[model samples]
Target: MDGVTIIDHPLVQHKLTIMRSKDTSTASFRRLLREISTLLCYEVTRDLELTMETIETPLMEIQAPKLEGKKLVFASILRAGNGLLEGMLDLVPSARVAHIGVYRDHETLEAIEYYFKAPEDVVNRLVIVVDPMLATGNSSIASIDKLKERGARNIRFLCLLAAPEGIRNFQEAHPDVPIYTASVDSHLNEKGYIVPGLGDAGDRMYGTK
Candidate 1:
């Protein structure tokens, strides 16, 4: 709760409900994710620093405000994370992108990394990690760990759905990093799935199981 922000905007909530329904078509699900992500981006970037620059607008020159600092990096956890990535890019087209591939070992429920790529200036810019579900927190923690290893000091985690267990675990592991999500579901099922959550975000978004 301390390091989390729940985006309860009506539009986001409405779209999430449609996504949860099992009857929704794959095309609808993908489109909804893209739309909801735009709203999430608005909230997450609310506090970005602004600077003034002189510019001429028709009649006279006046100081105009522009975003300060280096381009922010959106580090997406592979496969499913890309679903959110597409929409976030729409809002911040100039932002740098990073991809991290982490898979869960079904039996042990541990995260294993297979691929990772990031910009050389990652350490200097703010990094926002995107994932669809925070069920176990293992992947989220591991992915952030990899980022820190590469000198990333400022980081944030964003997901569409989260579980109490996952939230607690993620906070304990990375208290400095804030979390943004549309909903914190009731709980995680025995198989590490969020209860009442839209089933397999990756599968729903891409029509793949």
Candidate 2:
């Protein structure tokens, strides 16, 4: 838990409860995820550097705080990550986007990369990787690995739910990157699912198997 921050806002907790219910419809689940993700994004980027810029309101000129340096990058880990991506983008529309396509191999739970596209200026920007569940940590780790390989130094990981096992694995693999999640669940089940989790996030979000 040293490197993890839990977003426990009342709104976030309330929405997460509804998302966890199996009775929730896909449309409802998706809507709640987008809403919760915006809150999570607020917490994760709380410490972003700000610079003062002169701006004119209607009457007079004033110095207002603006984000410093390059636009931050949101590197979403494929399909499920896109759910979180949509809402975060809603909050930071000017932020750059990166999509890393990595999937966990069911048998080994290893991450396999199929596609990757990112901004060429990643080396100087803060990159936040988003995924709904950090069950095994394989895909998250692999996606960050690719980002680092491309010269990304400042990085963060964001997820809706995280298993203790996955948190430990991800921290051990990439201790420098901080993790942000709504809840760190009890543990991972035998099939690599988080115990008491909302089930497969991608499946539930998209009504897939």
Candidate 3:
């Protein structure tokens, strides 16, 4: 509640509720994810610093504020993050994108990084790590580790939902980075999934499961 932002905006919360319902169709689920992502993205990038410059308006000369520094680099945590990326991009169209893939071993439960790609000038840009569900936090922490190795230090995380265990794990591992989420549900189930979560995000988004 204090450190993490739980966005319960009417639109965001409403869309998320629809996403949680079993009756919601796959098409509806997909559309809601994109809408929620767009809604959440507004708050995430609201604080971007700006610089002033003189511009000529139709009426008269005016001062305008332009965003400062290198553009944002959105880091999508493989599949689920991709769902969130489209919405974020609608907000920051010029931001660069990065993809990182990690899959957990069903038996061991540890995350394995399968692929990683980052922008060439990632060090100078703001890295926004996005994943729809933050369960266990192993993938997020591992992704951050890889990003840091490649010169990304300033990072913020965005997720559609999260679990307490995942947030705790992430904060302990990387205290500097702040996490943004639509909701933080109860806890992880025995199978390492968030309880009452919208279910496997990758499968839901792709109709795979």
Off by over 4 Å in 3: none
- How far does residue 101 in candidate 2 sit from its true spot (Å)? 0.6
Residue range 1-209, candidate 1, lDDT tens digits: 78899999999999999999999999999999999998999999999999999999999999999999999999999889998999999999999999999998878889999999999878899999999999999999999999999999999999999999999999889999999999999998888989989998988988886
- CA lDDT of every candidate: 0.94, 0.95, 0.90
Summed over model 2, clashes come to: 0
Kindly report which residue stretches of model 2 are placed more than 4 angstroms away from their true locations once superposed. none
Tell me which of candidates 2 and 3 scores higher on TM-score. 2
Which window of ten consecutive residues has the lowest lDDT sum in model 1? 200-209
TM for candidate 2 is 0.98
Model 1 stretches astray by more than 4 angstroms: none
At residue 161, give the lDDT of candidate 2: 97
User: For model 3, how does the per-residue alpha-carbon lDDT over 60-138 read when each residue is reduced to its tens digit?
Assistant: 9988999999999999998889999998898889999999998778777788999999998888999999999899999
Query: Which wins on lDDT, candidate 2 or candidate 3?
Result: 2
